[model samples]
Target: MTDSTAERRHELSSFLRARRERTSPSDVGLPGTPRRRTPGLRREELANLAGISTTWYTFLEQGRDVRPSLQVLTAIADALRLGEPERAHLIMIAADETHPGEDSEYLAPEVADVPKMVNPNPAYVTGSSYDLLAWNDAAVELFPGAIDAAKPNLARWIFTNPAARDALPDWPVVAQGLLARLRTNAGKHPGSPRFQRLERELRTSSPEAEAWWPRYDIATSQAGAKRVRSRSGQEQLMTYASFHVSDQPEQILTIYRPA
Candidate 1:
């Protein structure tokens, strides 16, 4: 098997095990017993819940060369009581599905102009890995030094930059959300060099990233409100939404307006 395939299998195995251990029997409507030694539902219990053989499920958890159909995976997801994001992440890794716009990195001039068009609002365009591809004056004012960096990545800035804590009033919560989104993206693009490098940098530089990486959290980016401190140290509530570039799906245009 290729290195990427092996790495993906390992990730799949680890993610499954983590989710399984966190899911309690009571959570799945199974009677809980004090006699249970395992942290959560037993392997056989999960297998039965999913209508699969215990041995097969065990092999899958062990990262054996077992190919599970989509239907089976769905059944297992239901048994595990995984959320939508978690279910999508599981399917992406287990089935080794290729993400859309995995190789394309070309950003059209028109697409790059989107942020500037959204004048007064803090707007920026990011690549699939959250790299700051383009930003407007408002965005620069909102995020000082970030847009000026040689390789400005949102995730990297959130985790490694000390200024991020001051800029974001709720830094921990925001960081976790960003990390979860990154995790979901990582699942979609397994063995991506850019992602690998970013993960390594985060884990090495930030204690929170190191501790949270193994949790295997997954999240889809969504419209939300955030409290940001401007360069004047004035706190402001902003509503943010992201739009996918029609032609280049990997390029995301995010705009923040006063809430």
Candidate 2:
């Protein structure tokens, strides 16, 4: 299989495994068994609940060449109790191929300009893989040298940039959150070259990042607060909100405001 196909298969398998692991036997109305080695429902249990053969489900989880029908996917999703985003992502990965047309990764000029419009709020736009597509003056002022990296990769900056660690007082918390968000981005767009490149770079360059990657912590874009240290060495809390760009669904507009 090609790299894209292989990536899709890997993502599908990983997604299934993650979701399955998160769902417990009790959550699915099954009795907890002491013999269970895993935390969640076993493959056989999930297969039985989904009305499919254990062998087939196991094959799917193993990233084997198996195409599950829509009905089968829906059944498995229900059995795993996937949320709407998770369910949509599941369907997307299970598909043979994504829609072919324009490049979904491309951020339009208007979309890129969105951050500028949000001025003074420290707004920036990130692509699906968390690449810094665009940012306003406030973002540059707040993030400092970190965002001006050669690649301007958010994940890279979080783990590798000394300035980022200094600027964000809660470095460990921010780094962990960034890693979790990166994992989510990777899962959502497994075939994205940008994500793949960043992943490889991080794995090789940042030991801290490599160690945290396997946790498979998934994070969604949401409003939150961040504690940051200013250039003057004064610390302050900042509240941030994430907005999905309607024109470019893959791009997110994040604005950080003073708390």
Candidate 3:
């Protein structure tokens, strides 16, 4: 197998292990044994619950050459009690298809002008890795140095930058959502070098990031209301929505308007 394929398989195995370890027999209405040595449900128990062979599940967890079908994946996801986003992430990780790397998508001219077009409203465009590609003047006003050419990562800025707490009054909620988005994207793009780099940086830079990374929470960007601390020291609520760029679905166009 190629390096990328191997990496994808390994990631799938790790994701499954993490999910399995977090779920307990009691959670799934299974009998709890007194002498159980495993922290969560055992591999064999999970396989049985999913109606698959224990040997097959073992091979899958071992990152062997066995490929699972969508039906099997669905069963396993149900057995593990995965949420919608988590199930989607699991399917992406387990797929054998070859996905495009970073070079496949580029910021088009029209796409670049989107943030500028949405004037007065705080707008920005970010890549799948949450790298800030473009931002409007309003976005900069709301977030000082948010449009900086250097240090433009949303995740890095949220976790490591002290000013983030001041800008985002609801820091805890926003941080969790960002982390969940990262987890979802990581599964979709398993071999992405940008993701690997950011993962390392987040895990090393902030204690909160390190603690939350293992939880494997997943989130998809959608329209939502956010509360921010304005320059006048007043709490301002803004509504935001994410738009997908043509041919570059990973390039996220986010626009924030007064709520």
Candidate 4:
């Protein structure tokens, strides 16, 4: 098998195991058992719930080369009670098709100009790996030196930069959410050298990153409110929304406004 294929399978296995281990029997309406070797539903129980053979499910969790139909995957997803982001990630990593924009590094000139158009709103655009591709003046003011770095990555900044911690009042919560989103992106682009390097860096440089990396949590960028400490030492609430760039789905444009 190709390296990317192997990496994807390994990730799929890990994801399934993590999700299964977190789901309790009571959560699935199964009677709680006091005597169990491990938490969550067993392989056989999950297979039965999804209406599949236990051996097949075992093979999947073992990272064997097995192709499951979408219907079967959907059944497993439903049985596991996966949220939207986690369910989408499961299906994406299981498919054999190559991801769009996986190999492309080109950013269109017009697309690069979008952040500037939303001036004064602290707008910025990031690639699939959360690398800063473009930003407005407001973004520069909001996140000093982040966009000016040789290779600025928002994930790296959130986890490793002291300035980020100082700026974000709820640093731990924000960091965890960003890491979860990064995990979701990693599912889409397995065996990517960029992601591998970033993960290694974060794991080495940040204790929280290392602690949370194995949890297999997944998230998507969505509208939310954030609390930030201004330069004047006053806490300010900001509302933010993220959008995928048209025809360039891998690029996300995010804008923030005062809440």
Whole-model lDDT values for every prediction: 0.86, 0.82, 0.86, 0.88
Stretches of candidate 1 above 4 Å error?
A: 35-38, 96-104
| Cα-based lDDT at residue 133, candidate 2 | 84
lDDT of 1 by residue, 183-240 (tens): 8777667678778888899999999999998888887777999999987899999999
lDDT of 2 by residue, 1-259 (tens): 8667778888888778877887889998988877878868889999999999999999999999999999999999899887776677678778888432222367788888888898878998887777788898999889878577765867778777788888999998888887877787677665676677788888888888888776566667889999988888889899999999887666788899999
RMSD (CA, angstroms), candidate 1: 2.1
**Considering only N, C-alpha and C atoms within 3 Å, which residue pairs clash in candidate 2?**
none
Scanning candidate 1 in windows of ten residues, the lowest lDDT window is: 96-105
Residues 21-97 of candidate 4 have per-residue lDDT tens digits of 99999889999888999889999999999999999999999999899899999999999999887888999999986
Specify the poorest-scoring 10-residue window by lDDT in model 3.
97-106
In model 4, which regions exceed 4 Å deviation?
99-104
By lDDT, the candidates rank as: 4, 3, 1, 2
Give lDDT tens digits, candidate 3, residues 1-259: 8867888898889889888888999989999889877778899999999999999999999999999999999999999999887888899889897554573246788888988998999998888888888888999888765556464878888888877888899999999999989877877776777788889999999999999988877788899999999777888899999988878777799999989
Candidate 4 worst ten-residue window by lDDT: 97-106
